[model samples]
Target: MFLLYITALIIVIFLLETVVIDLFIVRGVKPDFILIITVYSGLFLNKTTAETIGFAFGLIQDALSFKQMGINSLSKFLIGYSIGSLRENILSENVIVQCLFTFIASCMNGIIYILILKGLFYSEIEVLDFFKDLLIQSLYNTFLAPIIFFMLNKVHFNNVREFRGRKEEARTD
Candidate 1:
């Protein structure tokens, strides 16, 4: 049941990010819902689970996109793994911090992805254009991250019992 809910959430976020928001509302800037989900999942979920979600979502994205396989998967895997490791160390439950991390991670992911693509394909994209798009997309993702995070947070809670359980744990510890 948990897996089903997460899968459905991923599908909805993917569609909303790529189809509804990117295609219709903001044609120029494409928000990275995958990155947001990966970061959110990593922050709240266990390492293996977070990485798995990231890998699965990345695979879905790669299958949907025309680009080569494994690129998205690898990037997302790294992002999820790294952030999950950080979460294990930090004890933060703040929404603002999560959004900030998502924003920074999205920016880093975009830059790293661009570099990886260039290295792999030897394609020389314009530097100015890359920065321009990166900035715009990062801002866009930052703006959208809170909404996605809130929705995913609810999924994580699952029910009032789960929420209460977490609150109890936090208070106890």
Candidate 2:
């Protein structure tokens, strides 16, 4: 059931990213829905589940992207694992924290993607332009974080504790 939900979410987000999201593009930089989802999964879900979702979504994005493959997958996997590991220590419910996480995650994703491309393909990325784009993308993702967080909060998958409690109750009974 969780897998099904994730699949549906990836499809919907992909469609929206390709179609509707472009309409709101500012300065040729668009909000990364996949990155946002990956971060959200990490912040809200268990580490294993978050990493799985991140890898799956990143693979899908890589397949659809014209850039080199596997970059997104690796970056998202790391982000998911890193952020999800903070679930116990961080105050994830705060809006500021969510935005900060999104910002940092977005920056990390951009840096990882660029570094991989540069190292593997000998791509010459201008430092200033790269930093400019990275900042823009991070801010854009941060701006959208709260809204996405609210929506994802309403999702049943976020209720992992309740599901576990029910299973435990059944086992005891």
lDDT of candidate 2 over 11-104, digit per residue (tens): 8878988879757598889988888988888877789878988888888889988876899999999999999898767767789999999999
RMSD per candidate (Å) reads 2.7, 4.0
TM-score of 2: 0.87
**lDDT, each prediction:** 0.77, 0.84
**Cα error, candidate 1, residue 3 (Å):** 2.3
Candidate 2 total steric clashes = 0
Q: Write the per-residue lDDT of candidate 1 for residues 1-173, one digit (tens) a residue.
A: 66688788788767776767536356477778788878877877778877998888888888888774787888888889988889855643676778677878877777777887798877788878988888887777878878777776676675534645775798799
* Model 1, position 30: C-alpha lDDT score: 79
The true-structure Cα RMSD of candidate 1 reads 2.7
lDDT for position 6 in model 1 = 78
Q: Which stretches of candidate 1 lie over 4 Å from their true place?
A: 21-27, 158-173
The residue pairs in collision within model 2 are none
> Using lDDT as the measure, which candidate wins?
2
